[model samples]
Target chain A: MTVSPTRIPEATVARLPVYLRALNSLLDSDVRSCSSEELATAAGVNSAKLRKDLSHLGSYGTRGVGYDVEYLRYQISREIGLTQDWPVVIVGIGNLGHALANYSGFSSRGFRTVALLDADDSRTGELVAGLKIRSFDELTAIVHEHGVAIGVIATPAAAAQAVADQMVSAGIRSILNFAPMVLSVPDGVDVRMVDLSSELQILAYHEQRKSTLQPDDGVVA
Target chain B: MTVSPTRIPEATVARLPVYLRALNSLLDSDVRSCSSEELATAAGVNSAKLRKDLSHLGSYGTRGVGYDVEYLRYQISREIGLTQDWPVVIVGIGNLGHALANYSGFSSRGFRTVALLDADDSRTGELVAGLKIRSFDELTAIVHEHGVAIGVIATPAAAAQAVADQMVSAGIRSILNFAPMVLSVPDGVDVRMVDLSSELQILAYHEQRKSTLQPDDGVVA
Candidate 1:
């Protein structure tokens, strides 16, 4: 379904890769097809919401047979632009950056870390995940050479904004930020912040509620 | 105003931490008070949505007076149960786990990593972020001693499920998963998966749209 990407809601777009992951897992287990309920369960969402999200891509499973796992996976992947390789530039070769560079999941899902850039001159020539750490000054050249549109910032909070500004200047429009602080990018530049602490805080909130409910049982703090 | 923990919607609960962070930033800047618009902008959310989310906690800012930065920060923190320290245990001490253990955000937000566990005996006793790496076998004792309800799993995909299962047996009810795989947790257990690849894929989807809109340029690959 050659659907225009703009038509899909932002929330639905965020869930597309999740559904794609679920489909891949099903395929890995030799499952060629799955009902909405099964797919939803695997994706950790409800069937109704899953069906609604899939509908955004103009994909509606057959009534009795459910969704074709391979077909749906292809559609979602195509929608998410995973059909083509995306060259990526990652800034900040710190611990978090090192972890992201070594993460195998990126390459498995069409994202190729073309270069790792750091301001620390001493770490510039270091090899990470088979890519040599380069100076941040080479960002523009790398972006142009690879026609890269995606940038990942795994830098410290203090340097996040400068890194983002540099990325925008280099013509990169989409960013995945691991820094704790918020980044202000120019219009048309998309920034997604993955706060590691924020995720734990959310879980802590729920855990606190559990303790609140069982106040008498101090054993579970 | 006092509110039931269950009354806040999951979406609002998830956003509470963002509001807390924005308020903390405001406090850091010496800002005593802020209008809903200011807070919302700092949090990267619409004012109306921000107001609505805060209303769930029974907090309605004064008309024209706005919200007290410190007061609202405390309110949001209390709502998210960040008022008290949360003992947390992180399993798997690989690259990603090491990064997570070294992250300062968790401690700043009331989460204290009391223990770091790894299955590899060779890694035991190694110091990471000032905490000594311990064996996974010590999970039960650590959970009991620290009253730890929140667990972090940074193990590889293959070992994530096993780590999660062990966490559940050790009385952990909340999990922040960094593994690129789905986990099967029983009811009452909450698992939040932070898939780094999925975040990039979401950005790639938007980046692809930007390119599609100007196919003639062909400059953005």
Candidate 2:
């Protein structure tokens, strides 16, 4: 009943991975507990910012006392919902998709790639990650059978919308879209897009600014 | 010479894009100006939060008059360093690479994909965006010629580091990596990665938890 201030900032939620990595490092070194200052240094963030971020997830620290490393790790993991297994489907078994299928982190954590879907007939029933690559036609059944409420679209941009529409139609409400287009999803269906090119382009804009401003930042053409 | 507050909070800086999109909608509707409340409503954010965010940039708002839509748009654009043009290179032309190649937004928004590269000789010399796809062998020459400082990697996880190492070797200091692996770059190099499946898995973790947690707030799957 006293959990009135459990509203963590979205920005803080994004930084949880950085904090987790820092905590993992501390754990590896057998450090039992850490103050915000020590954790922030390991995570490349400031102590004040680290403390403020952690404060949003309830007061985990005692006054003048550091946090219990294992306790904090477990808390953060639970906060991030990594305690339970999540059935995930990665559509489009192309090069990028293949790379994603081979990614060790997904299964190592609670996130499991239950199926790999592709539209091409040649790819169908082929082995990837020991699971047969299935056609998009099996999307609905696969998702339903696996209870996969989350889908990853690593398809070509042209195929992304159709894949998304299919995913939504198949009762999947959560999407990680890799296609570089704006997806118009219905209400309650959450779509989080990861655009490889756009991120690069934004970095390029800043890098260009950095180069132009410095004049000497570039190699002569 | 007096200028607008030059230092905006990093948190506020990220939100400017969301606000910019909101203002763009207003512009499309022929709306001239908007109060912080109006803009926040359109952007699906809180008015007080929006106001505080903009305040970090400067007093772009008139006390009672609110903010001029177009003027504020321009101001924020300038503040984000989007007023200038940036040339970018896409390394490793795969499924994700093709999407980046055709994405119209990149060129439209002060960011241009100057060239697309691949390591495979067979894939090289092929045409995608009118410009012939070139081999990675020509990387140093191209980066020099285009004054390119921003690089995007659409390669497999194995080739990503090599691509990054090549980009750095060619004098590129900023990277947008789409590969699902972590890359270690030298100092002064800015690396931003967009992992497609990771974001969805994260969402799925929350989405799964949302089903268990009644009346869930913002844990999007």
The lDDT for every candidate, in the order shown, is 0.89, 0.75
In the range A23-139, model 1's lDDT, one tens digit per residue, is 999999999999999999999999999999998888889999999999999999999999999999999988889899999999999999999999998888899889899999999
Instruction: Quote the true-contact fraction of every model.
Output: 0.79, 0.34
Clashing pairs in 2: B203-B221
**Model 1 segments more than 4 A misplaced:** A1-6, A214-221, B1-5, B214-221
Q: Write the per-residue lDDT of candidate 2 for residues A24-54, one digit (tens) a residue.
A: 7789889998887888887767889988888
Error of 1 at B147 (Å): 1.2
Candidate 2 chain B: worst 10 consecutive residues by lDDT? Answer: B1-10
Please provide TM-scores, in order, for all candidate models, with all chains considered together: 0.95, 0.71
Residue pairs with clashing backbones, model 1? none
**i-RMSD of all predictions:** 3.6, 4.9
- TM-scores, chain A, per candidate: 0.94, 0.89
Off by over 4 Å in 2: A1-9, A19-79, A89-109, A113-143, A152-173, A177-205, A208-221, B1-4, B25-35, B56-68, B216-221
Clashes of each: 0, 1
